[model samples]
Target: MNPIVLWFHKLGSPPYFDRFAARWAPWGHGLGLLLIAIGLYGALFRVPADYLQGDSFRILYIHVPSAWMSMAVFAAMAFYAAIALVWRIKLCEILAMACAPIGAAFTLITLATGSIWGKPTWGTWWDWDPRLTTELVLLFMYLGVMGLYHAIDDRRAAARAAGLLAIVGVVLLPVIRYSVVWWNSLHQGQTIRLFGESSMDASMMWPLAWTVLGTKFWFLGSLLVRARADNLRREAGKAWVAQAALPAVAADPRTEARP
Candidate 1:
């Protein structure tokens, strides 16, 4: 096997991944928190309000990044699911399952922050806007993936069904991306740009950039935490799990109680 592929294979091993997650989770969480704090300060104090929307638009600091992550996580989840289905990679299945709830949580956050931002600007808390409607469907898809995972008693079988669901649901991603452009919607179009002029000025844009990076790190930390816990559960009887599970974790009464 090629060296890089060999390293990646070793990385996917549950024991190695547990150790990796243990070491990296804290780093991801610490840096993520620091960046998020700085981003919040910049968003709240440094950035000027939109000349049109005033203070209400400030929620974009959380909303836009979260919205992006919701879709991005699902895309990632589906990719892993496809790998799990095609290659039968156990770690890919676990990672795909891990992504479902996190993506769902982000989707919910996006809806909430969007609603909060919408009330003052759109004159209502809820809308049937194409983007908003599609986003809600995305949340349901995440939930469906979770539901499918938990419905089966056999672990591998559950992963297979759930992975298939995730793969089929990938269509929602592009739909969600283009909904704003394809239809006349109340939600505003994209303002951030990579190469061209952005609709926002530096003061308003910089904080958003920081937050986008921070949330990605936070998501990494979150995924590692969830994946590690799930890995431990699935491998509870294995020797490596016995050796790797901390005394505090293994001794927890709830750990024994877990089905």
Candidate 2:
């Protein structure tokens, strides 16, 4: 097997995954937070205020990253769901389900931040614009997946059911992405482009790049941590779990004899 494939195959083992997650989760989280802090500082202090929007535009550092993650995480969940369904990989199922709450959180941040930004810019807290409406629907889709997963008694079965919904709900992603262009929408059109020139100035764009990278790292950490916990729960009562817990038990002073 290819080295990459072999490594991935090893990750399917709960024990290997537990170790892998433990090793990397903190690194992902720490780096993510550091990058976000740098990004925010640059956004607030380094970049000049927008000619029209003024200081209020600084919120984009947070808003755009959250908005991007909202959709990106959902797309990742659906991809994992597809693989789990096709290959019956338990790790993929756990990963797909684990993505729900985190994705929902990003969606919520996007909505809230968008609302805050809009109030000053658009003079309204809410609107039924196509982009905004589709984004709202995206939140509901995430909630629905989470709700469906918990409603079932069997963990594996619940994951499968919810994974199916995730796959189906992916149709909303493209709609949300293109809604501004497809209709007369109050939401602003894209200003940043990965492939071509962005309308935003370089100074303003740098902070956004930092924040975007931060969110990706943060999501990776969150996913590994969540999936590791779920994997441990699903594998409870097994020999490996007992062995895994032994070290912690041995290290606890409370586990020593009462003198």
Predicted model with the maximum TM-score: 2
Which 10-residue window of candidate 1 scores lowest in summed lDDT?
250-259
- TM-scores, all candidates, are 0.93, 0.98
How many residue pairs clash in each candidate at the backbone level? 0, 0
Across 1-259, the per-residue lDDT of candidate 2 in tens digits comes to 9999999999999999999998999999999999999999999899999999999999999999999999999999999999999999999999999999999999999999999999999999999989889999999999999999999999989999999999999999999999989999999999989999999988789999999999999999999999999999999999999999988899998897658
Residue 15 lDDT (model 1): 94
The number of the candidate with the highest lDDT is: 2
Give the per-residue lDDT digits (tens) of candidate 1, residues 1-259.
Answer: 9999998999889999999888898888888898988899999999887899998889999999999999999999999989989999888888999999999999999999999999999999999999999999999999998998999999888989998988888898899988989999998997888799998887688888889999999989988988888888888899998776567696787876556
Q: Model-by-model lDDT, in order?
A: 0.90, 0.95
Off by over 4 Å in 2: 256-259
Residue 220 displacement in candidate 2 (angstroms): 0.5
Q: TM-score of predicted model 1?
A: 0.93
